[model samples]
Target: MCLISFYLIFVFSMTLFIFGIYFILYDYSLFIEWEVVSMNSLSIVMTLLFDWMSFIFMSFVLMISSLVIYYSKEYMFHDYKINRFIMLVLMFVGSMMLLIISPNLISILLGWDGLGLISYCLVIYFQNVKSYNAGMLTVLSNRIGDVALLLSIAWMLNYGSWNYIFYLEFMKNYSEMMIVGVLILMASLTKSAQIPFSSWLPAAMAAPTPVSALVHSSTLVTAGVYLMIRFNLLLYNSWLSSLLLILSSLTMFMSGLGANYEFDLKKIIALSTLSQLGLMMSILSIGYSKLAFFHLLTHALFKALLFMCAGAIIHNMNNNQDIRLMGSLSLLMPLTSTCFNVANLALCGMPFLAGFYSKDLILESVLFSYVNFFTFLLFFLSTGLTVCYSFRLVFYSMTGEFNFSPLNLLNNESWIMLSSMLSLLYLSIIFGSILNWLIFSSPILILLPIYLKLFTLFVCFLGGLMGYMISNVSIYFYNKSLHYYNLSSFFGLMWFMPYISTYGVINNYLMMGQLSFKLFDQGWSEYFGGQNLYFLMKYNSQLNQVLQNNNLKIYLLSFVFIVVILFMFL
Candidate 1:
């Protein structure tokens, strides 16, 4: 079943890829619209947009999803619910495809909600407490974006059409459209896991690794960036763009710093995904939607590869994920390690690799754009931090002495998994160059000083060195972080983002819920509503029973008292 799914999806991916290329070459776009209803000058239509961007993105999504499905056959072979997992993954891919093709806000909402729902199911696939918590965080965080999209839909209703593509050009002329743009920005920020919504991206690592690779790399997280790209005109030159730039830069910086202190292999990669997402968002915020899209495509290729390699390692290590306990894996699992290293270097934007093309272009563009020093510093520092964590990951998990028990045997003999990874491996190597050439009709002119041009390369080298040194220091010393306990905890704990997202954001609301339960549901409502009415009725019934039991004697006394009262009145 998995193989059949893989073959079908792979074929579809290739077909879409070819179609995407043709569309781009010819600058052609196909829009299919079906009018569902027309009433009182209001027409409801379902729309699908097939253009170079949507086709290419859809193709990449399907390709990665196919490889992941193939990889999961081995990764989840021992599990009883493997079929369920495969179905959920396929559903996720479907949601992403729907999102990619839809230009209308309503149709986009359908796909957006589908991604959230399916992602929740996949995250909790393991049915453990951790998985459950992670799933909750992931869903609730994404729900914010869902609400934003819904609001945008409602706001766009005033414009007489749910099709946003028609309005993007004219929206900038009217100030009311700025609200729609802001709503879209909020939705994108949450979906992409930007600042204040980032904790879920890493916590979602509780999901199966294949899900991680697909969700983090392309489907769920990238949905935001994709949305922003579609609405680039709405956001371009708006205050929302500047806001997005600041938040995304902080997101990038925070995640990069957090990844360095993280030991969980999947979480580290997840943070890296967060960092890269911030990069995409930042670039998009600065009017380089195409550049952001370029980075997004290239990022998907290598990040998916990175996650698969991590999955393979975790599978061999008997489900252990702590990088601290892994070392010298290259000796035993040569092929997997090689693929892992390639993916890592590609992530660092190593020369001639997939990441280098997009990342290099993005940095140059940032330098070319007139921006504040703060944004510039965050960009370069985050770039270095990315290299730092990548190298740290390689050094700790792939090199040095073996840290596992001597009796444990590890090997990269899982042909099914390795083959799936190998499929993506070459793409991670060359996809950037291919995408760069295809996306741009002509070369982008980036004019920068010699020093500025070399800056990115210098940061990569320095970050790699720092990563190596940090790993060595930690290995040699016992509890080195204990000295800077508070500082370490802050960086390691994602700047308390999980706490803020879960405990911080929910604490007041939870307290209010509890209070409401006590004051209304349990206390006031119970007393004044059901219990109080019941007691009052009981008392009246008791008095009636006593009056009824008084009989003839009480009747005689009542008559005498009435006569006396009449005489006094007279």
Candidate 2:
């Protein structure tokens, strides 16, 4: 069978890269054996190259693919549509493999788009109205990202050397690096769900539990972070690096807030991931490439575990989704309880877990970076927000009082689900302590930060405690002040009109008493109404009407316009 062949090839790849993920997670390196792919493969025109970064990323993909299989095998075991799920997942795995292994940026893009297309199909496969909406939204948002990527390629092709190495060299010489920088940054921003481009990911929570668990949380969303790291040189040199930093911080805070307000089991994790990627971006912004990559690698492991555990939770609740109706899962399902607690603790970034190491590393790198105080503050605040929402989801779902129970799973729990979650929990616990040997070439530099690492652990737990307390209180009240002011009120609405009118004076527009424009009477048939009033009447309406129709038509036809007018604004 084709499935068997792909699985065997995948196993072989994992066996070859044994040291990649195992070292980070369990220090289980028994599987990986390394060999260099021939450097002289059929070459594209650009200078082809291989580097340590590419090697590490490929290895991470291999590990994730292996685990995804482990998950798919048990998760989709008996469903009538099992074959379809298996094929889709395998396709996802192959895309990830090609992405990480590719030496050329063009080649990298093949896997990037491949992963996105496959995810869209998987999300929509259930054919439910919710699933269909999620898939369409996913497609819409990712296309905004594709436009950015195509522009990035255009910039490179127009100005830089066509080869990867020469491209980097070419970038070093360009005065308009800002143009190239913005395009690349935009692509990654949309892909990573960082602000203004972020609405699609939350909507994507409509997919099945397993797909949500594996693809959305751990694998697919991580592609953007991988891209950022893969092209760090662009970030390191460009003026937009600081912009990336600030955007990342804002995204972290915003998504964290969303996750707190979410009720759906899958959505809680989905929002959590968007915030996690924000943290990763901020990490990259601070010049900590390896640190950010480690967090990505670390997050994929624990998040996958958490998503699977959430899947099991949904199954046990008799399809009851609201945390309000289900409670006391800790006692009801001990194994699920244990796995949930472990993964949640890891997600909470508890000490000594896989989450703790990468997180502390990111914070330490941020604290120590030469960036200014305000940047540090935003970074710190985002960190606090991530912890706040992560455990809010955990406590609400698995820890409270039971109000209802599902009939079929009143006491049912599957071994496959338990083992899959347990594997992730184990990896998150020990990943940081052992697997970072290659990343930390200097023992002494890593040693000075022991106290700071412990502090982050404490802060992580404290954030979780605060989240638990805030959960019972209404969110509106938690954020509400002693008194709230309405922005649309008379004073607030009129407050800015005078300033704008004053500025309009510089443009030679008379606001003295009348809204009229007198152009310096160039020899127009001015006395007879400018150049040709009768002729103008044939082609034009009032400015507002002309604009309203012209702009309105263009705007109305846009996806963003339709969504904004009908959905967001309404």
Candidate 3:
């Protein structure tokens, strides 16, 4: 069943890729609109936008998802609930597709909400406490973005249509539309796991590897980037763009730094995804949505492959995800190791690989753009940190002595998994060049001084060296992290972002909730509401019982008191 699904989706992906190229060649777009309901000059419409970007992005998404499904057939073969897993994955893909094609805010919301809900389901698929907590974090973080989208949708009602694509041009002139733009930026930031929302991306790794390959790579996280790309016009000449620039640059730097300190194999990759997302968002914020989209596609190709390789390794190693316990995998699983290294190098933007074309262009563009020194430093430093983490991961996992149980046999014997990875491996090597040629009509001319041009290479080399040095440190050596526990914890813990987003934001509220529970549910409300009513009813019944005890004295006294009160009032 999985193989058949893979083949069907693979063919569809190729078809869409061809159509996307043809559309790009002709600069063609197709917009289909259907009115769902009309109420007194206000019409609700469902719209589908078919353009080169959508076609190509959808193609990548479907392609990666299909490969992941095929790979999961082997990875999850022993699982009792593989069928349910497949269905959830399919639902996830469907939601992402809906998001890719929708231009209307309402339809986008449908797809957006679907992605969040389906992702939560996928994240908790393991049925464990950790998965459940991760799922809650993932869903709650995304819900903030959902609220932003809903509010933006509501704001769009002023223009009498939910098709926000139409309003992009006019948004720059109207001050009110700036609110919508800011709201959209907020939505995208949360969706893309920028800054405060970043903790969930790594936490979400409690999910199965296949879900990570699909969700973290092409579909769920990129939804925000795609949305911002679609609404690029709203960002032009807007202060929101600068805000996006600063925030995204910081996100890029932070995630890259976090990746360096991380030891979890999947989490290292997850943080890399977060860093790349920040890169895409930063480029998009600088008014080069095309560059951002370009990076998005290229990133999807390599990042998905990287996760698949990690999954293959994990599946072979009894599901141990600690890099410290993995070593010399290249000797046992050469093909998987080769693929893993390729993906890692591609992630580092090693020259001429898939990432280089897009990443290089983005860096050059940033250098060319008139931005403050801080943005400039963050961009280059983040690029370097990316290389650092990639090298560190390789050193720990592929170069050292075998650290696992010696009796365990690890090999790339699963043809099913290897075949799917090989497909992406080829794409990761060549897709960037193909995309570069097809997406741009004329070559982008980047004129910079020789020193400036070579600066990126220098940073990458320095980062690689630093990564090697850090990873090469003997375990017997003085542990800096142990000595400076708080500092290391802060960096290793993503600058305490998880705590800030989860505990920091909610700690006070939770305390308030506890207080409310005590004061209201268990205290004042309990006493004044149910308890007070119960006591009043009890006292009244007791008084009535006493009055009706058949005591002539009590009855006579009550009647005389009532008669005297009436006489006094009269």
Candidate 4:
């Protein structure tokens, strides 16, 4: 029964995906709305604004969700809670669809909040300690974005409407409304796991692989980028945009560096996801929103495929996530190896692949923009780092000696998983060209020197060389040759991001909390408001009791004393 339902959903989603693609190709833009409330001067509305952008994104989301669902049938066959898993994924898909179509802030909240809550549910679906911890971190990190959205909505009340679309033009004239952009930027950062909020993204690997494929790759993480894309018109020449450019470039460089030191297969992919997200954000920050959206879609195709391949590898290798234990699988599992290599190559922006179209455009756009040396250096270096880690992944998993003992690789090749992977592989190869044709009338033109024109190619070659050489040599004597142990450790541990985000942030707040408790809860408030007040009340009550017991005589004596005092004054 569950299997039947899963297939039904997949079929239904696929149908919608095809229809959406057709609609987008026809250049059909729609504004569908219904009035929910008509107040004295304000009308609450429920609206779905569907255009080419939404259609493209929604179609991709549905398609990826369908494939991920199909893949889950075999990957999660043993689990008793498979039905619950499917339902959560469907809910996630629904929430993302809502977000994709929404044009109003109030309506977007319904989807934005839904994503945060549903992702928390999905993350802890395993109910293990790791899942629970990761879920908590993921939820808490997203809560910041949630709060920022709510605050932005509240601030938008100044316009007497929650329809942010109406305010974009108004915002241009009123510079004071830049606060909304800043808040929205904050929200986007948390959702996309930029910088300080980045720990949860890799930690979120504790979730099932299918969840990672969807949430990290196509849907949840991109929500921020999608939001920024929607709001890009408002951010023209804004300082917040410049800040995002700097921060996102740093994020890109940081994640690339982290992926080099990472051995866990899934976490390496997750960090790569982070790095790509940084690319999307940095490009969006520079005001090339269309380019960002293009990359987002192409990235969705390949990254999801990458995660699926990684999941298959993990499942076949007795759930071992360490790449150190994997090697020479190309000979053993040709299909999976081929798919993995293709996805990795695409992610590295190999020419003619899905990623190259958007990634190359992005780098060229960066070159064309008026950016400083720091930003330009980070962008190019991060580009090289991307290829570097990708090659390292390929070498570690596909080229080196078989580190693990022999297993029946033939038995591990599940038809269901392969079908799902191949479906996406098909898209990963051709989706970018399709999008380029549909969206751009002609290719963007840029003129640069020969070296600059071939910058990405040069970087790719240099990175591949470094990756192949380092991965081969480091595997045998990594520990023996580590002279700069501290420097190596810093990059390995993601610049201590996990430690800093967890213990570093927690310790400071916890110490402050303890001090606050001692000073206010225990010391000042307890002494003055609780204990001191209680003692003072007790003394007053005792005095009152004494006065009441001797009230008659004491009243008479007091009256006589007053009369005598009055006589003496007179």
Q: What would the C-alpha RMSD of candidate 4 be, to one decimal place?
A: 4.3
- Candidate 1 lDDT over 1-570, as tens digits, reads 899999999999999999999999999999998889999977778899999999999999999999999999999998887888888888889988889999889889999999999999988988899999889989999999999999999998788888899888889888877888888888999999999888899889989999999998889999999999998987666788889999999999999999999999999999999999999999988899999999999999889999999998898888899998999999989999999999999999999999999999999999899899999999999999999999999989988889988888898848899998998899999888899899999977787899999999999999999998888898886767789999999998988988888988878788999999899878978999999999999999997887798599878888999999999999
Candidate 1: which stretches are off by over 4 Å? 37-43, 478-480, 529-570
For candidate 3, write residues 362-469 as lDDT tens digits: 999999998889999999999999999999999999986999999889989589999999999999999999999999999999999999899888999999998898
lDDT of each: 0.91, 0.67, 0.91, 0.87
Q: In model 1, state the lDDT of residue 526.
A: 92
Q: Each model's TM-score, in the order given?
A: 0.92, 0.75, 0.92, 0.89
Can you tell me which runs of candidate 2 are displaced by over 4 Å? 1-10, 19-52, 159-161, 406-408, 444-455, 472-570
Better of 1 and 4 by lDDT: 1
Worst 10 residues of 2 by lDDT: 489-498
RMSD of 2: 15.3
- Please identify which of the two predictions, 1 or 2, would achieve the higher TM-score against the true structure: 1
